[model samples]
Target: MLSNGHAHWTGDDPKQVYAICVASLAPVVVDHPQSLVVGKGDPATLLCAAQGNPHPAITWLRDGTPVSTSQDDPHSHRMLLPDGSLFILATRMNKKESDAGTYTCLASNTHGSARSTSATITIATLHSQFVVVPVNVSVTSGQHAEMSCVPPRGNPPPTLSWLRNGHTITPNNRVLVRQDGTLIISEVLQTDEGEYVCVATNPAGIRRSAPAILDVIVAPFWVKAPRDVAGVVGGRAELKCRVGGEPPPTVTWRRAGGQVPVGRARVVKGRGLLLEPLTPQDAGVYLCTAANTAATITANATITVLSPPRMVDMPGDVEVEEGQRLFLRCTVEGLPPPLVYWAKEGSQAVLPAGITTTEQVYLSHSEVAKAGAVGGTKAQYEVATAGRSDSGHYVCGGINSAGGVMARVTVHVRPTLPLPPPIIAVPPTNQTLPVGVAATLRCLVESAAGVGVGHQPAVRVSWTHNGHPLTNSPRHHIRADGTLTIKG
Candidate 1:
């Protein structure tokens, strides 16, 4: 083609034609000038030029696929240059590992076709680093334990998941995953103790770490009476021990000297020991033990007994008022139970208060008070009257299997008071008066001597006639005991 708008050809001669034929017979050659550069998910282009007769047409193939620019679509396009160069818009498909392969630029003309060496464009896939998250784990009953998941290395960042006992443990109140990729188990129960795994996955591959096992141990507790005890004659005492372990515990009892058990003693077992009817011979060291495998623990209990109190005898001679209530009590303290009794003093083989009698016997002041008795610890007597019959001495006695004792009290009652003498009236006389009614004044007394108030006359009377004194000497009337007197 020429600018003349018409086909213009020269050198039609044999030599000229021969030269043109030779040149047309030569094969087309294509060359790519620039190396393609592109990032993931971006476009790139490879330049290719071809020289040949009739202006060689150029075509491009990527990964064996033909490149056609005639469509005018961004995803697939091409441009034919005046110099027979080929330009194609290689839109980046999803960047992926599979997008790497050979790309060839093919140029062809009427003479022949030629291809440029492959300009391979590799699209790298987005990748993340891999990390192995380490789990920091511990377990206890009703407590929280922490675990972690991490990868070796990654750019897009890997996802972390935790597993326990081969099962995926979800994030919850009981199980939690921290921002730092740590797994946490809240309220770690006995069942929570187990093996755990950490798994990390990415576009490249998936990885898992070694399983971690956690064992939880629980401590034991005390549950029984003391194991040891000691006691002497006439003393108070008790026995105790302890039993402790996980899943509770069981308790049992045994003799220290390995002797067969006998009566007068009772035993209870189950995290503790029980004793009944303790006595002087029963006093000694005792042992209590508890065991449990779940808690992997055991414990022991020890008890000691001491001496008994000495016994004291009751006193003699106890006095009380006629109608007053009375009571007598015996005092004793010891490891073993003690018996008590009461009786009258100076009585033949005295009865034990209620012994051989139907009424209940009182051993202490409280017991006596409950019996409607008017006395406390000491005996009391009610005052009926002041009479010789109301005075006497009484006694309270106490007796027990260990010993006997007694106490004494005295009581007194007094008599009531009597009336006083009568008043006297007299008439004055020149001289001494004759017998009775011969102008004489006198007083009559009825009280006994030492029987009036303060042992003195409660009433007195005086005689007067016209405010004049009577005869100095007059026969005097007096009652027996001299407590009463009269003028005649």
Candidate 2:
């Protein structure tokens, strides 16, 4: 080998000779250090990887020591990987108070060395505690019930739950729990009567409080409801109801939203609503209510007050010839309907205004309907064949639970003609028609052929329009069919 900058190769030590342009390397740590906080008895990981032209080596240390620096640790807890990273180089599993401290990660290469910023690792202790106690709940049946539980916060907030009768039921239509740990029952029922317990749970453990008893008393109820009743005037009426509950319930009665008038004859309170000697005003709706310490129930009924009968459309005395048929018609309106009859006047006959009819003949019973509809009941007496002996004083009577009504009509027997009122076989009503349309009007007659002994005269039907006779015209015609027609 030449000494002066001139290369003269000598091969005695060939391994000592090398050729290179140039190589420089320096490790640079990751720009940031991570501070770690994990639960005690848990594992923690730290990273200190570096970058350089040549791959850097990773090393973890505690308080600048290559030896174990963890307090009271028996052995090293680190595991280094081939890629220059480790699970725990100076750390241990199941970390304790002594394991919580500043740690450093160092990386090195042929060019230079680098180190990470101090990382503070902390091991947190977690626990849960009882904060509030749920007490025994006593709520009346059919009332709102509310219960709650409170627990001290943990590392994480604990989950809360409520249970009944040792079984956990979720919040539903009947029961619900709020985020604030309140269990609410909108309407407490018999099924809600049981013991309750509050349960608290966290990662640390679970705790259940002592059972809190829930008592739900039975609510008052109506066993027998008041039914609608119809009572006669000057009669007695009564209403009753049966109530049962855990505690004796109070019962009261009212009429038409007001108190039933109290009197010796009308005792309207208590269960028995006695309307002795009821009047027309005593009829109305009534309410009966039952109440107890738990709840209340009500029952109601209608009271229909009835009145006496009254006669309508009475005829005056009549004169008819022998061998004539007579038609006796009478109508009466009253409450509770009535039974009508015809009585023959005798030497000792007398009439009273109550429900009493003596020495009478059965005629026909009438249909019951609203008095305001058509007429009331219709009672008709017809004599198909008659003689001089048929004439007499005839009394028509109607009787019901309220009272009686009667009317008398007298007749004379002679060879005289007695005009009879015309009864319509066809009734007429209004109608609408186009100007060019044809229309008809009909009128039929009832026969009174045997009404008198004399030869009867022919009957005639006349037409009237605005008080003037409607005569034959180009648009109007009368036919034998008793119809009036108009030509279109």
Candidate 3:
């Protein structure tokens, strides 16, 4: 204070307060806003402050647009507090990748507005995504095989490779990976079948593509041919083998030295040989052939056929009338048709020589196949008018180089029924009655079975008075029931 004269100032004086008070200045930055780093949907803030004669107003702008206080908008929201500070309520980077940009805070008043430097915010989409899906592929052998893998580049690009049996495959002359992430195998083979997987990698993360299956069709091949087979006489024999290939090979059975239908050999199903009623002569090598358009394979196996005469048909007990003809038959199957002989069980005499017959009880005329004709023979014994003396047990013996069989036959003679005598079942009875009445006499008789030179013979009835046969006159009436009615 400069007084007119040098006067001393006292407390609580009104004239002393009338001193000088001055206020005049533009806005001055107290704290400049700093850059910010945030993720999508995360809270962010930019600090800004300015000291001015009239307090400065705080404003926030992103890409030169004023930010709204409402967070529901599609942009970043910032609220300016009374203390000249900018507060980002919420971020707008949640929608798309375009939200990643610079953000700035401005402080303004009656003076000029000043904004902070750009805040380079990076909102990374955190996950890895696939664009191209691999697919399954099939190719024939000797053809090229390709397993494609095309995935869109992501935050971190992915790597592609081929895997077989869960292991990464190494590229050789015939197999290699193309530059565009395609697995290529030239001249595909059966061994080149597997799944190809593509893996994507980037700064964000790693991802894998769906597995692509590669299938290669191969030709047919046989692992084994027919093997040796052995069978008993009159027994069945079969030969088998193993086969391996694509589109399985067809197998056929053939004899090693001779054609099929030789002796008693035949093809069973499609894979083996069926030899029935085998003899020692049937012991030889056989071949099983497996073939396809691509390749053919053959294998040999030996067959041992044992010989033993086996009875295929035997006569059961024969029954005939006393004067009826009888024939007993027996059949046997052997490697070679065996000699069939007939004999009586207890008689010391040998059976007479008879004609050789091909008729078998079990084998009808049409049922004799080539194998049956070669391995079987039949015999029969005929009795002309069988009688009581001819009823006896007969034995049939079939002998072959391998073995022999015996069959017994029992013959029976049917007896005739004895004739029965004729008798009267009911005799005639006399009846007495009063005058002017009718009298009836009844007579019944029984005829014996198989008698009287005819079947079911009926007895003749006669009515006689005083030992005379009665006639059917006007006074006497005869009934069909052998009753005579006499009226007096």
TM per prediction: 0.23, 0.33, 0.26
RMSD of 2: 31.6
Q: Of 2 and 3, which scores higher on TM-score?
A: 2
lDDT of each: 0.48, 0.67, 0.66
Q: lDDT tens digits, residues 1-488, model 3?
A: 44653444557766674544435446666676665545456666666677765666666666777656543355535566566565655555544424456666676667666666666555434344456667878788899887776765643244566566568789899988887878788998756765667765443444677777676555543333566666875577877666545567777776677666566766665456777766554667777777666666677888766456778789789888776777888888665467887888788765787532454333333222233446667887787666777788888888866678998878998864544666667777757689989887776656554224322344556777899888899999877657788888
Name model 2 segments beyond 4 Å from true: 1-217, 257-259, 262-270, 308-317, 321-329, 339-390, 401-408, 417-488
In model 1, the runs with Cα more than 4 Å from the true position are 1-136, 219-488
User: If ranked by TM-score, best first, what sequence of candidates would result?
Assistant: 2, 3, 1
Candidates arranged by lDDT, highest first? 2, 3, 1
- Alpha carbon lDDT of residue 162, candidate 1? 72
| Global CA lDDT computed for model 2 | 0.67
Tens-place lDDT per residue, model 1, 300-362, is 333333223233334444354433433334443322223333333455554343322222333
* 10 residues in a row with least lDDT, candidate 2: 366-375
| Model 3 collision count | 6
Q: Using lDDT as the measure, which candidate wins?
A: 2
lDDT of 2 by residue, 1-488 (tens): 54444555567776655443334569888743588765554566766678886778777776676424232253556555455444554333253426666778788888888988888776544344457767877777779988777866664467789888789978888888789888898878866866788887654456787777676667765445678888776777788676656788888777775557568234344455777877655667888888887777777888776666667556788776666776666767566656666666884543332323222222233222322122245566666545677588988877877789999999776655666866668955688988888888787766574333354554556677789998889988776535677788
- For model 3 the TM-score comes to 0.26
